[model samples]
Target: MYQNLDLFQTSGAMARHAGSRQAVVAQNIANADTPGFRALQVPSFSEAVKNSGVGAMKMTRSNHLHGDTKAAVVARVIESAAEPAPNGNSVSIEDEMLHSVEVTREHSRALAIYRHGLTVIRATLGR
Candidate 1:
């Protein structure tokens, strides 16, 4: 299946992780004024890939060898250890906004990679 393809797997994973992270960032911003609410975070892209159980891979290009020919990603939720406000809320709107921008960029990068991969396939097939 296409899911096993490193290109697709990594791209899909990045998209999914970015989407989930955006949701969590929104949740944090929504709770910014709530009492006892701690800011939440999703694992970084690299960490997500590591946690997703995508094992190491090796390849042979005649006399050349390759590693990690495949990749995938997933995320886990964790609370930030930032200093809490007097009201027990740790959410910072500024930080959340920055995180939001980062998530958007990652999502776009993922989509671009997937799109280019498909384009390459189409060109190769002369379709």
Candidate 2:
């Protein structure tokens, strides 16, 4: 009966997204000194969800809905829009540090959501 619970799925997705973003930030930092290496970034969680059509109608069969099915919410890495330095490298250690902090917060928020959801479920069951 709980197989369709979206709360857990959402929290998990959020956590996964944060992890992906963190990886990209790490990559950017690692290449900070590489000439011509542009910084990379992933879109925000909200944008990813919106573009993926997470809550949209699904097509069980090709002809079922006559529309596109929901796409997987993937955290795609894109080239950052930051201006490149004289060496042609775009990564800024300060910016990457800030991104790391943001990713940490996002992961923590996801965990809190999942934990609170479990607590609410337990309370509902009088556990």
- Report the number of the highest-lDDT candidate: 2
lDDT of each: 0.85, 0.89
Residue-level lDDT tens digits of model 2 in 1-127: 4435778888889999999999999999999999999999998788899988887877868878555565568898899999999999999999999999999999999999999999999999999
User: Each model's number of backbone clashes?
Assistant: 0, 0
Instruction: Name the weakest run of 10 consecutive residues (lDDT summed) in model 2.
Output: 63-72
Residue pairs in clash, model 2: none
Q: Which regions of candidate 2 are displaced past 4 Å?
A: 1-3, 59-71
